[model samples]
Target: MILQRPGRLAITLAIIVSLFLLLPLLAVVPVSFTPKRFLSLPEGEWSLRHYRALVENPAWGAGLWLSIRIGLISAALATTLATLFSLGMWMLRPRFGGVLMGVALLPMVAPPVVSALTLYFFLITLGQANDLVAYDTLAGVALAHTVMIAPFAVVLISVALAQVDRRIDLAARAMGAGVARRIFQVILPNIRFGLVSAFFLTFVLSWEEIAVTLFITSVDAVTLPRLMWMGLRDNIDPAIAAISVLLIVLVTLVAVSRALHAAWRGRKAG
Candidate 1:
């Protein structure tokens, strides 16, 4: 089957939609460089003071570092657990697998406020009992993020698992391969792309998580999103706009690089 190229009208509409979605975010670029202390577009002059504040302010640095650490930890934990659960469900095809999958997805489907409140009370209760994994601690926040994001990993990895040929598993078993070897060498290799997708998806979810983070953390584990929220609420600091611009640039770079790499691969294959 041959696919037709999009018509000029379709291309025009696509560009219009893209610009509509991106214009609001693009507005922050000038605000980030405003000479004024607050968030506003530059009047006549621009300054980098807000960008400098990201480096000079200890709170910003600490929040950024903490956010990176928590995102990494949550992504790792979510990916590992989701992989194991997805593998088990795919291989075993258990009776209650659908129910279990639904249970795993509750955090994602439930209202954010409900999930945040539930996690808040649970962590608060635990904090009263123990210091470790307590409310406002890094561990607690990371754990909350893991629970909230793991379902996404589960869905991605499960889709990857579904695409694998069952014959491969049977063939490996017929050759007297053990379960561990079959999984590590054969199954996992087949689903590597899914694993990567899940890892990055969960990492992004955890990185920008603010509702749950607001509930679970305070002084000690203030993540970048949480700090940005505080800045917006309390002072409407220009530094928040600076960070937003940086994130937008970073995401744009990654997206452009990936698109270029895919184009290069397609051309090579052609």
Candidate 2:
């Protein structure tokens, strides 16, 4: 079949857009390899010194670990709450579902400054100001992130749940299968991919979150991005570039793996 020429322009435009989106990341990878301590294009030599420094530095290591811990905890909390909320919305009436979903999405759609200010004030009033439960505490940071990312989780999980075939539930009911048994044995298995995708997305969102974390966390509970922000303020170091490169690589790998898994599952399902 011959394609129309008009569509060719759209394809070309898409390629250009993709390249534009990828340029900064492409530039960063090479810059991470620069031998100079300061930010610059690669000159005479390329070195892995920055990468080495990142791995060997205690502060960076601790910050990275803290970020990972917080991200995992927040993701788990968000995923659980979102899953239940989405399920409730799906099972209930349209008006109820719409209201619940809208409330869930409020945190994500609201202005960052508003969220930061509100949380700061709320925590202070709750007597968490200088205590372990205060702004800089790990629990506070995790809770803030959970609230921030729950909306996204709900949206993703709702999509997954929407894709589920209602007939499966009907059939199970016809056979006298209980709701718990049906959900565990039939529904979850079908939407496994969506759940996995939701988990990864939630995790990544929590991992990359900086705005709320920056305002809510102190030195002891500072996340990797927050630490990087402070480090950049003091100096422009290649170590930051190295950390950025590592993060990019990690996220890319996880995304690719999810895509491959989804593809493989699709084939198997077909």
Candidate 3:
């Protein structure tokens, strides 16, 4: 009982710290329902006015659709490349692989400004900025997102690979399983969860990307974050609150669904 006291105190302190960070999120939920022209607490009434604007406004819808499309494309490309690289690295057991892994992690580790600046310079050197981003675009932002997100996928998939038994791979290779067959048959099936996790994570990261997108795009590739940014600067429209609310609800539902799925799988396995 005495030994557990410190642990209980630590857990309680952790929960307190978490709640402190989350208080702002909790406060935003009600403000999202406010019917006022400006942001404030709803004193007497609440309305769906802002939410209606989100649904009816063409700009919001367009931004959302574009974000989703780019997110999907970037996620697919990043996850596939990460999976292949992780599998290949494990197979090769290269001497300088640690250094390579560190280089791969630079995007995630470096400050946002550094990555943004790097991509900006890289873009200018390659082709016209208008063609890549502002004038009209899909490929530009999608490709940038893939590069920024690939490291996350690599780390996740590599962790999944590490959990696998090397003996299975060795046994397969001994039995004359070619490189491709060994990867597809032995390594991949065990890492399905990691692949799903990486895909979803990359999709979310791409969807929320702002710094790099801000540098690369002007109008043509305007994503939801950019739109919201413009709105904040221009109008601080009440609709922004409603969008926040919807995003919060959507992400919460997805999280809950994932948790339920994991629980069900655990039970099934047990």
TM-scores, all candidates, are 0.97, 0.84, 0.88
Cα RMSDs, all models = 1.1, 3.4, 3.1
How big is the positional error of residue 132 in model 1, measured in Å on the Cα after superposition?
A: 2.6
What is the RMSD, in Å, between candidate 3 and the native fold over all Cα?
3.1
In model 3, residue pairs whose N, Cα or C atoms come closer than 3 Å (at least 3 residues apart or on different chains), thus clashing, are none
Best by TM-score: 1
Best model number under lDDT:
1
**Tens-digit lDDT string for candidate 2 (1-270):** 997665888999999999999888878888899988888878888999999998788889898899999999999999889877877676554666667678889998999888988887766665543565567778788888898898888888889989988898789989999878887898778878777778888888998888887778777887888889987888987789888888789878988997999999999999
Per-residue lDDT tens digits of candidate 3, residues 1-270? 455446888999999999999788778777878888778888889888888889889999999999999999999999999998898798898999998889888888888888887776766655563555422267777888888999999999999999999999999999999988888898899899999999999999999999888887787778999999888889788788789888988988988998999999999999
Question: How many clashes does each candidate structure show, in the order listed?
Answer: 0, 1, 0
* lDDT of candidate 1 at residue 232, scale 0 to 100: 93
Whole-structure CA lDDT of model 1: 0.94
Tens-place lDDT digits, model 1, residues 133-173: 87999999999999999999999999999999999999999
Model 3: per-residue Cα lDDT at residue 191 = 92
> Over all chains combined, what TM-score does candidate 2 have?
0.84
TM-score, candidate 1, is 0.97
